[model samples]
Target: MALPTNHSLLLPALLKGSKTSINPSFTISPKSPLTISETFSRLKKQRKVGFIPYITAGDPDLCTTEKALRLLSSCGADLIEVGLPYPDPILDGPVIQASTIRALTNGVNFQAIISMLGKVVPELSCPIILFSYYNQIMKINQESFMSALNYGGIQGLIVPDLPFEDIGSLKKRANKKNIDLVLLAAPTTSNYRLKAIVDASDGFLYLVSTTGVTGARSNLNSQVQFRLEELKKETSKPIAVGFGISKPEHVKQLSIWGANGVIVGSAIVKLLGESKSSEEGLRLVETFTKSLTSALP
Candidate 1:
């Protein structure tokens, strides 16, 4: 499919220029957060394992999403992945798929997320990584999308289903904007593929601990320890393990095996999914995030 160059068509609500528009209070002024590379390097020197939590934007509501983001940052999150609500999510399991559906049903989109982030990013201490699929990225186009990232203080982007062979152009564009195109490395990836991923992925290589789609599990894939060790041998860049990470014990185990960070998603998304009110959602996020962070070295 051809990407639409006209970004105005990307989000009518955002470009409408009303009080409900994206720039109601925050202008499209560039306010970039720290780069993902710098954040990982800083953590490496500090000898701290980064904790990145994933949440769906506008899940309970967009307003609640903002509060939850701030709460996560304050709760010791090194980075936050805000899943841009898409009609189709390539890698999401039921928990995240349900959360994404909730947000989309409430009118969350690429532009809405950018609008929400514009006001929320300035207050956040850590970098924000936007998790989006390929078509959604194309819908916003490249340059305008990068501009929106700056406007929203987002520092990283993850296209979960993007082909490794096709990442050249997008990765080049992201590099120009200092936005890390974080790539995933699964347990089944061969060393040749892993080597390519090491060279291509910025910030850190996202090691999917399981072979299947993302969801919380009682225990992690036992092969993750060996995979972490193998990745450490091949690349100097940080390695952050994600997928099936739900428990503090999982976080501790990853850290002990030399992981630079851990990304927890379905578990946190589930917490906010059950919330009856914004307050309850934020409270659940805070308590659970603190538990995960405390387990990290």
Candidate 2:
């Protein structure tokens, strides 16, 4: 599919201080305030595809989570998705569910995650997108949650459980704080609603590869390519496919299918948990991120 002249898929913001991100004419903020669209537009200009990896904060401990986050950015992740351990993760698979359990058991809550990001965000090269459930935000109220994200210098958010039709006030609050409220689209979404989601979403639109929860799969659903093509016709927003994407080949295929980015979650979570130590886990994450990113066009 030929991309719209004004709608090419873009890259995440280049790391601050890196030659790629430096511009002599303008002053760059200490904290990267790059919106999701700006980052994707950069990616598009560079002809690079996005690699987003998800990890549960405070999986084993906050200290480890901090290290892992730094490793993800330095490695190859364009945007990192940091999952807040919620009591109920209906959209997550067993691997991600186990990660949430470990995080919750280790006493990681919303406040604790915020504290961890406060220290880690300053050191990160790429933007952080917090993955949260709608209920968690409701308990504290949307405005409070947005305030916490802004305070931590978070650039984006992915609320898997929030419906696009009902995201009015929540999205408004996020916009006020300059936080991108990324909306998700499923293969099952109807055409009219898909357009609504595309119009409402900031940063980029998440396209779920399957109808089920997040996990690594041996084979992608055969219809995913068709869905990607279908969505591209509705809107020019960057489309990122998530859920069940595990291998480099999957990333390559999605790129061919017109995905601006590919989000890998359960695979990274499983890898982190399987590692013997936090240091090793960090190494594994960095290595895995590099491998997947290298596959991007």
Candidate 3:
């Protein structure tokens, strides 16, 4: 099935530019939470797995990053993950690490990143999730970070480095704002830890397909299927598998394994790096985004 047109879901204020400000005193609807399972179900009915592509914010430059995001959303993304540039991104592979370095070099700090998003969010069709390390969040006052994210129209957050034991304060803040806080469950995670992480997670459970950093791999681990099965039995929330998922075949396999979503990052960023200009980069990403998403089922 073809993806739904944005006309049905685009915010009215976005169309007229009349709603320039997000009402600070406004309250979120209790039913407005964007859950992983809900997103997966919506995609499943369309015979597709959610395509969540990640790109470092301000990579190359903020303009390119924004263009890439708009392009991805226009082409076929169900959701977009904007990686906050961090100095020490341990979980990221060389490609992402280099992208982060470039972004930081271009003066992409937390405030700048959020400010950019505030300008672009009103125009976006797909939901935007901020992917960052805990330290980046810690550097700013917690309340301030949450306020900025809310103001920027962020739907969710993913902090790969945050441990289950250390999520209380963050969870409370996220819950208060009605923003989903997605937690990652790695292959190395024990069952006890998995339950804890899932219990704390609000939007969806991000299952890292491997034990290490994020990068493209020749093949996915066969064990990822079993892991998905186990996780399915534990929670009704959608399970999105990332880490080393770089190819169309991986996406197909993930769907067959009952995964609700597939996240492709390094491969997409690598393509962007190869393009000569931001416009060319966006075109390339759009083409690939449609191709990979079309192969999901």
Candidate 4:
């Protein structure tokens, strides 16, 4: 019996004769698509918790912000969240609030941040996530904002004021540009609200560790562990606990409670404010980042 005329009988014979017989000239390689969720999950599986260091862009100066980010990357930061200074940052605490004010006073605006990122993105090793409010994003026009973000090499976005109900347009735009729109889940969120947020969020979920504004707390809220446990039961996506995660012990506890990453913001911002010089500021950031990374289980 012979194979059908339409079938390539010679191809199967060639493939069986030698491993590379199919096509010696061409390589058969598989390319895997990278997604934000997959990247965060891989970090979680390594038993290495992610260290997300947040800093206000142009706080003190844009040059210092660039230097601090590079230092954080070198010190083991998995992702760096650059806060875009907003006139009213409701979710921020006194430290971040002060930092935002300073950044604004230094003339940091939407265009300035985009320009700074354009200059610094090429040098950063870790993923850069922009932390901004909806008003700022709206001011830039969604299309322009997305275009600038993509060009600036920003991997993800965190808009604290963007509600699930208002996420459709942004989500569509972000998904089109392959940008992850990370949604926040606060301690006060109801189960129904959490489910909605999880469904809409991409990359990793930002689980606010406390009920109030972002800041450094003496201890991790006991409710945080419970909330994380509940969230884990609900969604398979990686949950990065933020908002009040300051100390190494807090990072450890978050890891134990099944958090995929721990974000330290106010603590890092506070350190930057305390350091007298840019070099010293970067060193302090590196030291603090190392401590947090080392504390992860």
Candidate 5:
């Protein structure tokens, strides 16, 4: 299939422009929260392509995470994916796994991350999306976790390890809390499973660029464009590609491939970890984020 020349056709609802806040009033209530569609709809009106950057909460420390969140929002991130540190992160690559290990060693856990979010989310302009594994969600009572997310002002959730075939209960629970359960689709996904994942995804479909774990790569797979086109036919919902995405060129190419958004994880996480200090780390993230956003079509 030939790609659309007009980028607006990629995801018109996201490119059009409206109010982008998940909840404009800043009310802390998951029961009556803003939908992901509303936030994307607002960005659509502004004709801005979404830029999602991931970070491991408390990797360096909670204070650094706080500063990073503020800097990321001010720089260019449309939505921030905060990775909740877990003991076994099978889906994460070396960069992310190392960051999580650092976070965990520092005594960072889901509850601590939520506490940090509660303080930082109110200050951020973009929505906070908690990324975690299924085991952690199950470890805590589901309802309680939802309540904490609500109280923290989070608008989205992404469980990469949750199989699409078995996400029914988790999806339902997140829906009840008015939180978007963002699902992932991989290059290796079957037609049947791809359709299910696309339909179930709330905020945007996270299309993994390759079959392997998440990490930065110099070149995205050659089949990425074809795979994105195939996923597009499955659903009109916003599609954001992740895994192996790093440089501005990757963002540009993916945008041309009809991606509504781009998710950069390892690259950002590595930058944060490599920084000499909190201020330097925030600056590194800020500069890199700006470059990625500027590359969006």
Candidate 6:
């Protein structure tokens, strides 16, 4: 199958030092915020915990990924994480690693992934947050890289391996393009370091549930509640919990614990990769996503 490529996917000639977003499709003012921040802010007003689903782009195939994105938007995902496939391990667990391998094997490259996003993002009801590693963008001109993503309708970015000290500059560049450079904080993060992450993180902070890689587990650690409470006390920014959360009950538990958003990744990736057919996979995604949202209040 030929992957969808949008010719309009040119590297956008975006203006620099401008707080406005670079998407030609929309006129954004300098003070206008990225969609992810806005979404979280809205959810905060409604006193609801947002449901964010993660999927490896071009996994199994780009077509399936596109269909999945569309379905997820309509099914109740407040925001979607479109993971850019990388060959090396950057803390991805078994399920996501396998999905990444499948995507790479299918010849899924950055251009193809951006093309698909450019074509489908306008149709999505929710914002897209591209999850990637630092090296992927390090190879290119940082401004141009951010410009490409902004043109494709990516509202946020998550580079898991980027160091805390190096984050300031990157965050500034992404901010100029109207992209939220979300940072991650783990269970082991020191209070001082945690405070820095909170201040630098653009839209929201990704709070890792466990110390290990991203995957589904039988139970969420009891300490996660305490962690959420501690982090919430620190900032008004949204905190989305990821890793080890696989079921609706878990989501219910997190919502009760005062989480602003919950990210279900490996469970959903595992479902899509193990399904016998694309239709079956999407059916499962729809049901599971709805159930997850139902748990959010």
Best by lDDT: 6
| TM accuracy, model 2 | 0.88
Q: Estimated TM-score per prediction? A: 0.90, 0.88, 0.87, 0.86, 0.87, 0.90
| C-alpha lDDT of all candidate models, in order | 0.82, 0.80, 0.78, 0.77, 0.78, 0.83
Q: Residue-pair clashes per candidate, as listed? A: 0, 7, 0, 0, 8, 0
Please give the RMSD of candidate 2 to the true structure.
10.5
Model 5, 65-118: lDDT tens digits are 988998988886788899998889999999999999998888876656765676
Estimate, for each residue in 61-150, the C-alpha lDDT of model 2 and write its tens digit. 888888888888777678889998998999999999999999898877776677567667878778889999998877666766776677
Segments of candidate 1 deviating more than 4 angstroms: 1-33
Off by over 4 Å in 2: 1-30
Candidate 5 has an lDDT of 0.78
Model 6 deviation from native, Cα RMSD in Å: 5.2
lDDT at position 35, candidate 1: 66
Ranking, lDDT, top scorer first? 6, 1, 2, 5, 3, 4
Tens-digit per-residue lDDT, 1-297, candidate 4? 322332222233332223232322222111113345666766867867777889999887888988887788778777889999887999999999999898888777665566567556666667788998998776556755665676556888999988789899998887777789999988788988889898888888899888879999998888888888888888888888898888888898888888888899999998886578877877787788888889986
User: Over the stretch 38-69, how does candidate 6's per-residue lDDT look in tens digits?
Assistant: 89889988899999999999878999999999
Candidate 4 backbone collisions, by pair: none
Give the C-alpha miss distance for residue 35 in model 3, angstroms. Answer: 6.5
lDDT of 6 at 231: 85
- The lowest-lDDT stretch of 10 consecutive residues in candidate 1 is 17-26
lDDT of 4 at 42: 68
